[model samples]
Target: MEELVLYGTLAAAGASGPRNPQKMKSGQQNHNNSSIVVCDLHSGTPYQTFKNVSLPRGSTLQAVHATSDRVFSVQHNSSVLLVYHWGRDSAVQTIVLPEKLAVVKVSPSGNWLIGGAQTGRIYIWEVMSGNLVAVREKHYQEVTVIEFGRDDDSFVFTGSKDSTVLGWRLYDLVNSGECQPVYSWNKVHSLEITGVRLGYGLRNVYTSSLDNTLRCWDLERNELVSTYILPEKIKAIAMDPSERAVYAGLINGDIIIVNRYKLNPTTGMVEGPKGNNEKVTLTYQDNSDILLTRPDSDTKASVTCLDISFDGTVLAAGYSDGQAYTWDITTKQVLRKLAPQKEAVSSIQIVSRSRKVIPGGIKLTGNNSNMLAKKKNDTSAEIFKLPIFKRILDEKEIENHNVWVKLADAPKQEVDDLAQVKVKMAKFLHEPRFIASAKVSKSNVAALTGRVKELEAQLQRAKDLKQAKEMM
Candidate 1:
């Protein structure tokens, strides 16, 4: 059993999803540890959990949003936004805003991040630098939802509790640093807007509101395309890839499927089959044409959030009672169910890519500055100790002495005794090599005199020998 426990710990540490452009397959922020849990969709297993992530004081983890390789979470009633990357135990970046945030979203290209505050302000940031690109006070109440343009990252749509939805060009927001909304629709809903989604071609923006209506607006013309009135309050909405269906999660714990191409109320159903067409109008507590009914665990719990998988084949729904269900979109069968927390599940996201494990942990640690400081400290103790002014004086004096020595052999002009004394004094400052060379020359002269005396003595000895030979 001890060995098994160790094995499980190791598996949890290394078992990650994929490292592609899509950062996560599915993720949620649960009550346990107030952490973000990433799960593998194929295996329906928990891949990794980010723990002890930093949030604002007195705040809980309210939402989890992801970019290509980073996961961001916003805190409830707090201005702090926690950023999580692979292999990090704590938030790598904590972006603090002026006010507390209620919702957050990352762009499809992973270049921008946006957070909506309860103060009716939306803050936009460039992801790479964490620079605040723009802040707009476009809503009168709390901002509820922020969504990127599905076709491209050029535009972003936001819905607010003020019952308005505004669209803005991302380029203008970052470049001009202005909070202007390019397109504005006032009082689109009679109540607070809960969720917003942009179509694949960006031709329509779908929004659900507390007023119990799913409204679609055309982007190019900035006009209403259609409205599907539901019986119960719509809490969240998600669209499939084909743009053929829009799924609405209701407050009564029911999921409703609305055909995207069909069911225009003003005009009769025209494009789709007659049998497929259902009544576009809904009454209170109606589940007659619901797509997915409530599970036994979440019988009357409000569906708080909903997400569609990348392939549009799976639907993941989170409930206020903390039940999370994954369903096959085609068969409307529950594939898996989980309850990670006893509290409400604030958000749910379904992505396509696997997990990314960032090697060597965090990339920012003041390492360069630390190395520079160490190098400075090591060299500060060993100074050159150079003689400053005194050394320059010594060099100048030596140069003068050298000039005196070089002029020693020149013809001496007639001068006074005092001048001659000054000349000798100047010569005294010359290098010692002059005195050394003079002593060496005198020693050679004495050696030559001794050799001559020895030669004379030898010549006298030879003469004395010659006289003795003559006497014989």
Candidate 2:
């Protein structure tokens, strides 16, 4: 069981803001220490680094995502999306977008890629076909967050600075000529939305806003489920795998953990906390919520990003101070402290490693010639390449897109092949053994027909003799 953590920085300390277009354009020429680092979780040593001439000196906040085989990141203040493979040092493909994207997310199945642009427009693309499926402007301001439902990949949830969250079905966006959201919730928060998370079955959606509130909505009912008010602005949010607890990162460098269920003494069963418009307000003095702080109290760097491990036992957090920390959930202790970047940590991801297993363990003998020969002789290894995305969608390409359908089970039938049957018969006649067997069968059938005819004649004569005896 091995895991790797990938993280990138915003910009070097004392550098200009990432939104400066002039600075971003000159990033490639300048000698900036900008790279995506992949390191081991247990040990803080970086094992792989993705650096190339095409990557920007600064990356936008939460603009990075990793799939099983590729890594995706957006360039700050630019319309470029850098894609890198696992073992490649440079970007394999640089996707040119119509506008600069604030955030991007790859679908769980790795078939679709969706991004929210600075102009509040959403762009969706087919990963394999390189087709721009949809480009729509729905938000009034810059799009901040984009997420796909874990249980249902076709369901997408997006939030923006307009203080709205919209739910969409992927199929509708791709197939329909004019697409609309399945559900839209507007004016839920007074300020811009910062983070969004979907609960089990995609029925419950949790969102955090700068208005110092964490609101949960019931997608099925299209209503607000619960709201947790915090003292300070919420910068980032994450949930455990079980959805039993929610974690909110504050601007004051405090991580608050809230439990969704409470124990009922009378019933002796756990029940969800009742929702009210003005009931729940979490404060620093409240003992109901747990607070996690950095070791150094003087450092008040806000948490920029947060991600929980697959097992829900560890929490990875990145901060404005360019540090990433892994915390043990149960013990509430820091497992590792990694601060390799000089700028703010914008993204963090924890992914399991993929390994290839051999049928039997290789022997470690002194003779290494066999291993070298096997490696030289192996030609089945394939180099994984990222598909080059088309900037503009072509009508012809869309019309030619292949549609997939699942065929139902039916009775199987052999194909009729008259020519093949004739060829087989000709071969059978040409064979000496088959010809002898055929002759024997033909002679046996003729003899049996003659014998039957003789038996019929004998029966007729016996009947005549019986009739003569009767007359006498």
Candidate 3:
């Protein structure tokens, strides 16, 4: 099992104070030599760092995705996908993939796990059984990113470095092992695809590529609705909670925010011309841009990944130089900037959903219990008991005995009445044993009084006899 890594805890954010390069070396454990730091976004500071996690000796950490209960991480050049409880060093499970994975994602429901491999074969595993349910070989190059539809886990989206984006129906993959995508667009980007996102109700899927294009697709109609070609290569993207807008992080360390399509209230579809609208011209917007470099600084760090809070109030962007910034999405102002580390921040995840915190500070949510229950039921041990032996009897005796036993086995009410009677009778018989300890009776008093009277009469007679002897 790989050593477990946790990024955040419920502790005070300033427990470790600001990030220190000297303390960074001490923050890691001796056995595992790296740390996964947890930060409290509410306090905007570092909370805790876990270092005891075991990883493949020479492999580097890849992407990290977490639900309310568990944190899932993958490693480069390693086939094992390590799972850890939120804010703990103990690994709950390790899933072995068919091939080394470059990217991994868990459904919002946490019932599914998908690992994208370098060979373009995507492995899908059912979280309940931890079994590989399907292996999809749709992309020709490395699968760069994969995401589940926000509405549910039934739909999955994948983008490959081969410059294509495909939408897969999970039901078909699990039921029939179908590798062909239900919705697909080939060579949508001129360069490698970097990020893929399922916008809002999953009706719109977004893709960002190195060719400097952000394409939006209408998955329901399988048509490209809009495309925003940028000035620089885009590395990462995140959608707001309301699905009103999307933020794109570019290689130039600039964060670009773009508005998404509006939905029709009655039809619950994109509020545009319906059906075969592929001939419709695409709309491109380019006014939103926020630069990361300070006024006094000349160096610019490339934005590597982006994540928005559950409420869409804050936006977190990770840069190529390991620096990270959190901005208030409404005001478009920087909230906090974390110190730089040695490696680039490949992914950013904001802990959002509220969870029931159990004693000892562990989360006792439904997902954690389900994971434990699955592990217990998947074991193959069978229980066995020795059979009892009985002696054979003659038919006549057996008949007589069986008849008596059946007759004695009366109704439950009658059995209960008989038990009460037996208890009363036992109490009545035992009353005699306690007779000596009972209170004194009238007969015992009368017997003592008679004995006293007899002694007094004897004393009077002796007195009379002594007087007669004196007179003689």
Where does model 1 exceed 4 Å of error? Answer: 1-33, 53-62, 87-89, 177-179, 262-279, 283-289, 354-356, 359-364, 367-472
For model 1, how does the per-residue alpha-carbon lDDT over 232-306 read when each residue is reduced to its tens digit? 899888898777888999888888888666566878755742322133575545545556886583468888778
User: lDDT for each of the candidates?
Assistant: 0.62, 0.74, 0.61
- Superposed by TM-score, candidate 1 places the C-alpha of residue 446 at a distance from the truth, in angstroms, of 86
Positional deviation of 37 in candidate 3, in angstroms? Answer: 2.4
Best model per lDDT: 2
The candidate maximizing TM-score is 2
lDDT of 3 by residue, 262-357 (tens): 568888987643434233222234343434332223557777778877678878777656577778777777777754554566666776544432
- RMSD per candidate (Å) reads 27.3, 11.0, 21.5
Q: What is the TM-score of each candidate against the true structure?
A: 0.64, 0.75, 0.63
Q: Write the per-residue lDDT of candidate 2 for residues 146-177, one digit (tens) a residue.
A: 88887668799888988998888889877737
Residue 43: error of model 1 in Å? 2.5
203: Cα error in model 1, Å: 0.8
Candidate 2 deviation (Cα RMSD)? 11.0
